[model samples]
Target chain A: MNRLGLGGWAILVLAAIFFITPLVMTATFSFWEGGDRYGFDSYRILLHSPKLFESAWLSIQLSLASVLALLVLLVPAMIFMNLYAPRLRPVFEFMATLPFVVPAIALVAGLSALFTGPEWLIGTPFYLVVPYFFLGLPYAYRAIDVGLKSIDLDTLTEAGQSLGASLGQIIRLVVLPSLRSAMLGSALLTLAVVFGEFTFANVLLFHTYAVYINEIGQHDPTEAAALSVASFLLTWAAMLGVLVLGGGRRPAVGGR
Target chain B: MRSPLAVFFIVLFLAVNVLFMLAPTAMLAIQAVFDDDGAFTLEYFQALAQYQYASSFENSLILSLLSATVGVIAGGLIAFAVLKDDAPRWLRSVVTSFSAVAANFAGVPLAFSFIATLGTLGLLTKLLKTWGIDIYAAGFSLYSIGGLTLVYSYFQIPLMVIIFFPALEALRPSWREAAENLGASTWQYWRLVGLPVLAPSLLAAWILLFGSAFSAYGTAYALTSGNIALVTTEISAVLSGNVVSEPQIGAALSVGMIVVMVLVLLASNLLSARAARWSVKS
Candidate 1:
């Protein structure tokens, strides 16, 4: 209450308005009864549609698969970076972030070109999983890297060695447990991104969750609005959950 | 113990990353140069001189620059207001949180929401029509290039805020306090101490924002429905099997985009490096 001045207030108010405008409009339009009638019919229609449920399932599966793959890839990679290649950390970090900076369409287009034809992996759910890994890599990598940095990895490893623990046992018992919060937070964030991602899903013609938004947009605007509201809530809830659970964790080891 | 298995996994990870990340981009460049018949030519690059393709490039660059500039200015203000100014703690936190969410909010959902608000049958449009103001008739279409920039700015502003906040937080509090204690005005204190310290980061962040806006396709495609021929949508259209069925042309367009992205990435890296040095010195 004391820190923010008039200027700050104005900015906050303006930002809130801008951010909420779309969500509010969508909710209103979805609920507004007009022409024949409305009420909750739009939502009802959305609920009854088998395609909506199917897409939701597909989205969940894809997100879960991607999250699992990211954990497999990132956990070891983070540990490796922490133990050996600290100097190359920034380069690896930059590479993970490359997908974000590149336009989504362009990446999809390039990927489509590279993998189309008899070589076409575009139709496979597994291919979709690949790009999802790239998209989720930065967040997961940063999260794990941060977590790994906070703990004394060298001492822990040595201590485990002295106790006659194998490398696998040491990683599982000492490292993995220590990184629980970071892993949870990163997984949640990755889920949010993969769930909402549309560009690749659309281009690849996949039945992921975001495809439902596009489909509803074309066929039923009202239903689409309802779906958007649901999505906004889902992603928002996931993000908040992560923050609440992982907020108090220490910053990544040696993080500025 | 630095086991051989650990070394093998590390090498394998790096090699796999290079293959996946660099292969597509390299393919783009290779396709741009060679036809299906393996004939190398400058035909695609020459096509850049044509009005259709040239205009798209020019429009993409201009729109990206404008949106990034506007986004950074607005974002910087909000960041400064939250971090440096005597703003309300709750209000600052709210703004920060909202911006983080909104920054990630783009593409179809964003476009659809805007259409609901401002399109011909939009909520605001209907309200304006009731007031006898035909906003559409006044030549304001939400599907135009300018309209896309406006929509893109919505997300970009929050993105800039996110990127710039940490850099702003790195500013020493004593610098501001010192300036204020010397009877300097608020504006002068910021101008002499804050802006100089933050300039490099600002530039780096603006480039990053520019790159993001430039490459963005979802909101642009959804809002404009591929009618607005920016580089991203151009590539999308080509790949959608619509305009150019030839994968080579789609590859060429993608290659062009990667070139621009790489250049932007390089510039941003250099700028960030400079900013890091300044931060260390201060």
Candidate 2:
């Protein structure tokens, strides 16, 4: 309830306008009827396009595939590292973060060349999925690593072992449940990155949703705007869902 | 009790994941040193020198530096207002949430929005024309490099704000109160106390912003259509259209970008470590 002077209020208003202006403009342009009238024809056209649905479905599939792959790969590795190789944690963390420093387009360009020529993996969906894996790795690893740092993995494992549980059973039953909120956060982030990724999909000519944006960008600006709006909404919703699910959870047992 | 098969599967998965991550970058770096004649040479680098690539590299560096500087300063002000001060609750929450969402909202949609707001047929353009002023004729188009920087700042500001918020929050209010009790002016407190404490995070944030701006291809490519020569867009254009047809030069450009980004990241890491030490000592 702190009060602000007129100038401070003006600055706040200006900042808000600056942040919202682009999104507002995109929405307005999506519905502009080439003159004064506004209509829902642009959205209708987008909905009617068969390619849009196919690409949207493909995008969902790819994003889910990447997230699932990350979870399967990262969770056990994280559990092992937390329990056995905490000293090497930083090395893995550094390696996972390299992709973020590299430009997405540059990474895709390098990756596409490696796969398309002499390597010959471009013909498969696996190559496209690989970069998404890299995209998801840093965030997933960081989230899980932070979660691991907060909990007593050794004690948890010992407790499970005393119960006559196998290592796999311990990980599945003990470690994962404690790390659910962190895992959910990582999965949601990975999903967001994979879903919105445009550079690789466009370069590789993958018919993902991002490519749908690029395609509609060429022939129909309005439809492209509609798709962009859809992307914004989806990304916002996923982020909000993550915050709601992950934000208020109690700290893992034995956490600092 | 015996599961060599499971062990073998685990080893194979690890090997394949490493290969997936490393092979592409390694292939490009190796190719960058080889030439069209199948001999190792600096010919690609030479070609880069002769082509517009050199200037493009310079342009990218300058633009990124400028954007990062401006972004950090703006972000610092906003973060300070929200975190360190007793700002209005509603305004603080709005900025915090908006900063998170806006930081991720970039690329083509960002470019398109800027164009719609500032283009010839844009809202401001129409408003200006009605007042007997032509913004375009006055040398104000949003497609140039400078205009692109302005557009980039929209997201970069939010990014810096979010990244620095934690660092700002970690500053103890007692230090500020100590300075105030000694009759120190605000500038004196900031100069002697705040700047040293915040220097590492600010530098780290700047380096991250620089790396982002340098490698940003989508917004620049969409806005300027590779017409404006950027290191990333140039490499993408060559690879996409077979313009170079020599993958070595394309790889060389990628290598160049990777090298620059790594150097910045390394420096930022060092700076952050130093900052951590400083914070502990203080």
Candidate 3:
């Protein structure tokens, strides 16, 4: 029964118009198979495109790899930071935010400049997991940091130690289970990044789902619009996943 | 607290991050300042003065500034409205969740959505034309920087709401009562108490939005197909140009971007410190 005031209602209405028009229009435009015709033609075309399947598969693989790499590198490091080297919190934080400075465009350019690696490292699409991991670092680290801060780590570790648990067991059994929401949040973020990523995949000559959509867009606007709707829904789902799973914490999103 | 295992993991973490994160940045700086002979040079930096590169930087600055300003004002208001005492819980939950999704709703899909809404023969374009308002004839092409500003603000506005809402919420209700008790009117209380406390967070959020817009590539690339001279697209052009692939010049532009980002980062850090102090006081 609370009121948002006249100004609030107006602002909200304007925001809704601004935000929803494009999405609604995109969906409408996708269904229009040109001039009084409307059917599932665009969706059919997109669904039948092998390129769509291939690239989507690749993006999913890359997302999994990136999330795995990110979790492996960050979870233990965060635990270590919280327990032992709290003084280095600022340094780690600074490092995490470093990716914000080097956006994907700049990172890819710098990456190409520094691309003297062995072919095995830079040749395959799997190498992209490296930069993807870097891209996810800032948001992922913050999510994990928030999780770590919320839990009583010292007490948990001491209790585990008194119960004759190994450090590995303590981390696996005592810490990570409590940090599930944080891990899920970071994983969802990495998923969003990998799925929506285009600059690196395009420049690096890998055809990700995004790059495929861009290609399809050039030849078929309607089909591309259809794919765009799907992509938007995917992003919404991932973000919603964070909200639902993170227990209403503000998910670290945006930038790049 | 200082276990050997923890030390080992910390060192490993540092090594992995430094090698992946810092090395590329260092390599970029080196490439920007050095030549094929491996000697120091400034030719690439000088190349940034050329019309294409200079204009891209100018265009980017203008676009980012425009979007960030609009985003902050509108988004700040939206946050304020959502956080008002009379606002309902459902409104807060919906706005928070939508902001989370909308903030991440950028890149190619965003570009496609905008195009479908505003491009020639687009749904809205056709709809408006029937009402006697030809936007394209009004020179409102979705391919221009102005068009990009409108699109960029979609994500930027939501991002502002997400980042600034917490700071706004941190304002204690008692503070307003304290100001009102001193005979200050609502406007006076906000001018003296609310605005001062919110300034740092607002500035920091603005800078963050600017950085986000400035470095964005996929949206502009997909929207204009690199027709617009954004620094990001320009870097892509320089690297992918078959006739004249100047990786050095690309490095120069990337370095310029890094410089601007570093400045934004430093300003953000300082502002965050100020905001933190304000939050602590409140």
By DockQ, the best candidate is 3
1 versus 2: better DockQ goes to: 1
Q: Note the Cα lDDT for every prediction shown.
A: 0.77, 0.76, 0.87
List the DockQ of the predictions in order.
0.51, 0.46, 0.63
Per TM-score, the best of the predicted structures is 3
Candidate 3 Cα misplacement greater than 4 A, ranges: A1-3, A248-256, B1-8, B242-245
Q: Report the poorest 10 consecutive residues by lDDT, candidate 2 chain A.
A: A1-10
Winner of 2 and 3 under DockQ = 3
Candidate 3, residues B64-118, lDDT tens digits: the string is: 9999999999999999888887877798889988888888888888888888899
lDDT assessment of candidate 3: 0.87
Q: Is the docking of candidate 3 incorrect, acceptable, medium or high quality?
A: medium
Write the residue-wise lDDT of candidate 1 on B60-109 in tens digits.
Answer: 89889999998999888878777745555676667666666777777777
Error of 2 at B2 (Å): 13
Weakest 10 consecutive residues of candidate 1 chain B by summed lDDT: B84-93
Q: Which stretches in model 1 have alpha-carbon errors above 4 Å? A: A1-4, A36-38, A84-94, A100-102, A117-122, A251-256, B84-86, B280-282
lDDT of candidate 1 at residue B132, scale 0 to 100: 100
Clashing residue pairs, backbone N/CA/C < 3 A, model 3 = none
Instruction: Give the top-scoring candidate (lDDT).
Output: 3
